[model samples]
Target: MKKDIILAGVGGQGILTIAAILGQAAIKRGWHLKQAEVHGMSQRGGDVQSHLRLSDQPIWSDLIPFGGADMILSVEPMEALRYLPYLGKEGWIIANRTPFENIAVYPDLEKIYGEITRQPNHVLIDADTIAKDVKANRAMNIVVLGAAIKHIGFSVEEISDAIRDIFNRKGEKVVEDNLRALQAGIEAK
Candidate 1:
């Protein structure tokens, strides 16, 4: 199996964490993984994105060419639109409904949502709200990841194990909270 995913969000949205979890999971499953990160003032709430390619076969490049991404998992809707050119015809866009509103003049959220929903395959979620509801407000990224679980080609249990492994250093509370956040995300879809 092969999956080319683009993870997008503003800085500090845990884009790297999501990539790490997916990378770890892919490694555990004996799959080949390639990732390339693009940072636009990532330390100042600017755009942060990564191209993550996973497959049972070896991947030759870390970059995903235009119109080649199988999925775009974004923590922000507007950021999701920024990578539309990388999405394949059947690619799915799993993104959060919340906007960071970092720009001086942010576009209308309804319009942003409209553009995202216009895609043939998409899952728009209020991941921040879901994360809050799960008592893990900081885990909104994971919530988006959870929402994309079905299309991720990994079982919930497998992903959960990866989460546990990744957050093990943080503490049990974090791991459990993220797990709950993940479940809430899965349920949101």
Candidate 2:
């Protein structure tokens, strides 16, 4: 089977890092993976999107066509709506409820939340609050990633192992904190 995922958010939210971890995890599972990223004005809180494709066969392209993604993992609720058109009818969406004001005019939280939940396949999580509770608010992206892990069909241990391996070079504490943040996010929902 093929899995196509799109991740979107503003800059400094670690969108690229999440994509990297997912790609690495797919690699670890011996799946052919291709990832493409667009970082338009990302440094200034502009839109950032990464496309990831994983399959048992080789992928010829790194891009995902409109409405072709099986899943969309958004670091912010507004951003999730922004990319909603790209999600397929059976797609699953995991989005954080943190409102991002810098990116387009911010919408009413309650209205947006209601609309997002109305979608057939959507999962909303308070990743920002969870991150704050874990004292790692900057790891919001990782938190969303953790929440989406189950839908991606990978074992949490495998993803955690990939995370540990990726951040091991940084330091023990950093790895530990990220793992904890990931676990907290995964368990939150």
TM-score of each: 0.97, 0.94
Could you give candidate 2's per-residue lDDT for residues 1-189 as a string of tens digits?
A: 789999888877788888888888888989999898775465676777889999989899779989999998999888888888889989998999988787356778999899789889888999989988998767878889889988889889888988987888999888877888899878976
What's the lDDT for candidate 2? 0.86
Compared with the true structure, what per-residue lDDT tens digits does model 1 show for residues 11-112? 888999999999989999999999998665556778889999999999998899999999999999999999999999999999999999878999999999
Q: In angstroms, give how far residue 102 of model 1 lies from its true place.
A: 1.3
Which lDDT value does model 1 have at 104? 96
Each candidate: RMSD to true structure?
Answer: 1.1, 1.5
Number of the top candidate by TM-score?
Answer: 1
Name the weakest run of 10 consecutive residues (lDDT summed) in model 1: 37-46
Question: In model 1, where do residues sit more than 4 Å from their true spots?
Answer: 39-42
lDDT of 1: 0.93
Highest-scoring model, lDDT: 1
Model 2, residue 86: displacement in angstroms? 1.1
Each model's C-alpha lDDT? Answer: 0.93, 0.86
